[model samples]
Target: MAAWPWKSLARSRQPTDGGDSAAPGKLSLSLSELFVVGTWFGVATGLLELGGTLAAVKLMGRVTYDTLRTNWHYFWMTPLSNLVLFSVSALVLCVATARIPRLRTGRVVFFLYAYLTAWSLVSAIPTLHKTAEVVLAIGLACVTTKFLTKRRSTFLRIAPRAAILGAGLILAIAGVDVYSTNRPVDRGPSVASVAAVGPPNVVLIVLDTVRADSLTPYGAERDTTPNLARLAREGVLFKHARSTAPWTLPSHASLFTGRWPFELSADVGRPLDSAFPTLAEQLADRGYATGGFVANTQNCNAWYGLDRGFDHYEDFYENATVTPIEVLRSSRLGRYVVTSKLAQAVIKRAAAPVDFRYRKTAGMINRDALAWLSDKGDQPFFMFLNYFDVHDPYQPPKEAERRFTKAGGEAQSAANLARDAYDDCLVYLDSQIGRLLAELESRGKLQNTLVIVTSDHGEGFGEHGLAGHGVSLYRSELHIPLMLVHPTRTPAGTVVSEPVSLRDVAPTILDLLDLGTAPTFAGKSLANTWSASAADRDFSEPVLSEVDRADHVPAEVEDAPARRGRMRSITANGRTYILNGDGREELYDLHDDPEESNDLADLADAQEHLHQLRELMEQVTGVQENGE
Candidate 1:
C-alpha cells in the first residue's frame, strides 16, 4: 500500500489502454502537463479576476472614468495576485491528481478551472468567502469519482482549445476597457477656465461621534486629545460650534453644501440631490483636485451621494474584492491545510488579542491618507477625511485600552467599559493625527494646507436616556469641536466664542479661497468671524441643530409608525430652545445649565424666546407643532 490514501486510491484505478498503470508510491506531475495546467490556470485566473472586478465596479455604481482611473491598480493587482496564488494551488492539485492511473484524463483540469471560476465569483462578495470554499470541495469530490475518470482523454483534448479561445476573448475585452479608460475626452471650457492661483490646499477631517467635551482642548479633564490641543494652538478654535444635525448623513450634507439639512432632501438612505452643489463639486469646478478618504462605512459612502465631484474617493469599506487564497485561509476546513503550525501558534499567542481589540483602527486610515497625499500634485486639492475611530464598538488597541482600563476589572459593565474604550480610541486617534501632521510637514504640504478639524456630532454617554447619537437633539449630541488651521489667514491662538453651525464650513472654505458662495446656500460665510474685532463679528443668528428621528430610525424596528417626531434645537444668547414635534418645548439657559439639567420653559421670559425659536424651526423645516 502507498504511504497516503490518495496515492493508494490512484493505484487502485485501472489503466484505460490495457497498459500497466503507474507503480505504487510514484505519482508526480510530468513537465508537459505541468506547463499546460500552469499556463491555463494563470490565464483563467486573470480573466476571471478582471471580469469580476469590472462586474463588481458596475454593481457598485463606480464605473465612472475618475473612479476607474483612481482604482485601476486595485483592479489589476488583485487579480494578478490571485493568479499567482491560484497557480501554486493548481500545481499542487495537478501533482496529487497525476498520481491517479487516470492521469491522462482532463476531468481534473476542468475541475481546477471550475474551482477558479467559483473563487473569482465569491471573492468579490466579502460575505461569501466560505461559500467559495464549499463549492471547491464539492467540485473536487465530483472530479475524483469513477464516472469522470472514464472520460479523461477526450476532455483533455478539448479543454486546452476552449481555454485558449476564452483567454483571447477576455484579453481583447480587457484591452479595449483599458484603452477606453485612458482615452481623454473634451471636458469643455468650464474645466479649462477654472485655473488655480496657488490657493491653499484644504483638508477637512471629520472625527465621527466625537463630542466637543471629550477633547482636552474643549475642557475635558482627561488628556484625551493632546495632538488636537496642539493643533488648536496653531490656528483658531470655535468654542460654541454646533453640527447642523445630530448624525452623520445630514450633518455632512450641511457641511458640504453650506445649506441647512431641511433646505435639501437630506436623510438616511436617500442620496443628496444633485441640484445641491457639494463642496467638492465647487472646488473641482475651480481647478482644485478633490479626494475623499472616508472610514465611516455606514453613512458617508458612495451610495449616499458623498462622492460627488471627488476625483478620487477611496472608502475603506469599499475594499470587498480579495484573493481566493484569503477566502480559503479564512475557511473552517481549509484552515487545517492552508496555514502552518508555526503561523497558527503565533496567531493564537500574539494576534488574537490585538485582533479582538482593534477593528481597522486609524493607523490604516493615516497610511492611506499619506499615500494619497503623496500622489496629490501641486494643484490645490480638497481632501475630505472621515475617521470612524471615535465611533461606537469602541475596541481600541490593547495597548491603548490597557492605558485606561484593566482587562478583567470590576468596571466591566458595557457602558463603563465603552467609555473607557472611547477615551482610549481618542488617544489612538490623536496619535494618528500626529502622524498625519508629521507626514504633511515632512512633505512641506502642511504650510500650504488649510486643516479644518471637526466632527459630525457628539456621542451620548447615557445622557438623557441615550447612549449613541442620531436619536436626540440634546447638547451632548449637537455640540462638536470645530478648529481651523490656515497658514496665512487664520492667526494662531484665536478663539471664537460666537455660536456657529457646521453648515458654515463650506462657505467659510470657499470664502477663504475667494470663491464666491452659491446663491442657494443658507449658511453665510464666517470669514470675518475667523479673526475680526468684536464690532465686526455677527452674533445675531442662532445656531440651529435638528434631528429627524423618524427618518433616522433603524431598519430592524418593525411595525414602527411614522412618528414624525422631528426635534429642532436653536441656541442664541446663551439660551437653547428645543421644540419637540408634539407641541412640547423646553428652554435651558446654557450659561448656567450647560448640562441642560434645568428646564425654564414655563417661565414667562423664556416662553417668548421659545415661541420665536419654534417659529424659526417651522419656517426652516416647514413642519409645525403637533408632530408634523
Candidate 2:
C-alpha cells in the first residue's frame, strides 16, 4: 500500500563522495554533521517553546512585566534549561542511530524532533482543547518532517550558526537579570532626625497561618510555642485578638495601613495599592531604618507592594543557585512532563536533596534577619519578619517532626496526618523564634526592642467544615494571637480580654512610638488599652472581619453556602454575629460556646441583638444589607 516514511531517507543515505556536497535529490551526513544538525534543531525548538509560553502568559494578563523583571532569573533560567534538555535528547537519538544500521535513514529522528517541537508549541497556548491540540501537533509534525527531508542540506548548513546565536542571547539575558536583581538597596537620606534617646526599635514578627488555639499561650494542650508563652508572660497579650480578614494579602494590608480589607485594593491577582501610607513608610519618614525579611515570597514579595517603604527587603528566590531540576521546572516542556503522576514521583525523589522545601524555612529567615540586623548602623530600626513554615504542605525538619509525630505517621488519614505535620511545623517555628530571641538578647537588642508578635490570620483544620483560610470567616481563621513585649511600656503578665481587630495594629504601633497617626487610618489605637490603668482601659470598638467571594472554589465545596457572595462578621459584647453571603445569619455567645458549636440566629430572643449588630456593621462600613 503506502511506502514507509523513512524509505526516502534510506535512498538519500547511499555512500557520498568524500566532500560536503551530495548528489542531487540525495542527502548524506557524517556522524559529526548529523549530531550538530540535530542539536541545533533541538535548541531552536526550545527557543520557540520559551517564547510561546512567555507570550501566552503575558497575553492572559496573569503576571506583570515588573514581576518577571524582579524575578528575572527565571526568565533566563527556563530557556537555558530547555536547551540542555533538548540538546541531550538530540545527542541520545544520534548515538542510538549510529549504533543501529537500520535506523540510519534519519526519518525517526526527524519525526521525533518535529513531534516534540509541535507538542511544546501547542501546550503553551492556555485553555486549548485537548483533542484539537493532539490533531494539530501530529499534522504539524508530518508537514515539518516532509520539509526537513526535502531541504535537509539547507537545515544542516544553518543549524550551527543558529545554535551559537541562541546560546549567546541566553547568556546575555542571564547577565542582565542577575545584575538588576542584585543591585544595592536604595536607602534615602533621613527625612526627619531622631532624638538621641528615641523610641525602642520596633520588631514586628508575624507567624503566618497560625491559629490562636494552636499555641500554648492560647490554651493549647501541647507546648507548641513556649517562646510565645514566655513572651505572653512578659508582655501585653490580647486574649481575643482577631484578624481583619481570613487570608494573607488582605490581612497584611490591613495590618500595615490600619484600614479594613475592602477599603484597600489588595485581592487575588491584585497587589496592594499605594493609596494609604504603611507603618514602615511612616516609620521610615521619621528616620527609622526599615527592613522586611519574609519567607512567604508568593504573597509577601516586593511585587505585591509589601516592600514599599523597606530600605532592605529579603525574599526567597525561585532558584537561589541553579540546579538542573529547578531549571527543568522553569521550562515549559519540563512542566508538561511533570504533570504525569509517574513523572512527578520520579522527579520528586530526584529533586529531594536539592529543592525539597517549597519556601524558605523559619531558620533561614532568622539567619537573613540576623545578618541584616548586625549590619545596621546606629539608626532606630523597624524590622518586620514573616515566618511561613506553618502555612501549608506541612513538612517540618526531621528533628522537629519527631517531637510531635511518629516515623510512620503517613499511614494515618490525610486529615490526621496534616494536623500532625502542622503541629510539627509549629514546633520547628517556635524553636526558631526562641533562637532568634536568644540571639537578640545576646546582641543587647532585646531589651531596647519592642517585640510585637502576632499572626496575619489563623488556619482552619476541620473547623466549621473548612480546612483552609480565605474560604470562611470562622473563629478558627479570624482569631489570632497578639502580644507586644516592651521593657517599660508593657508590664509583665498583662492580658487584655477585650476583642480587638488587626486593623488597630498600625495605629497602636504609631501611637506607642509617639508618632502621629496618618489621616487615612481607620482603626483606633490600642495604646491606651495596654498603657492605661485598668479603670481607664477602653477597647469598646467593635471588631469586624470580612472575607470576599473566593476567586476559586474547591470541588468539594462547590455547592456550599460560602460560594454565594462575600461574608462579614461583627464581634462585640462577648457575642459574634455572622452575616453570610447567601443571606443567612449566625450568632454565637463567646462565653457559652467558644468553639461556636451552637448557633442562636433563629432564636426569638436573639433578634434584637442581630438587629443591633447589623446596624453596627452598616454604621461602620457604610454599606446596607441590600448593597445600597
Please tell me which predicted candidate would have the highest TM-score against the true structure. 2
Instruction: List the pairs of residues colliding in candidate 2.
Output: none
Candidate 1 per-residue lDDT, tens place, 23-45, comes to 32122334355445555655556
Top of the candidates by lDDT: 2
Off by over 4 Å in 1: 1-197, 318-321, 325-359, 398-401, 549-564, 622-628
Sliding window of 10 residues with minimal summed lDDT for model 2: 63-72
lDDT of 2 by residue, 431-469 (tens): 999999998776666767888999999977886777877
Over the full model, what C-alpha lDDT does candidate 1 score relative to the true structure? 0.68
Compute each candidate's TM-score over C-alphas.
Answer: 0.67, 0.77
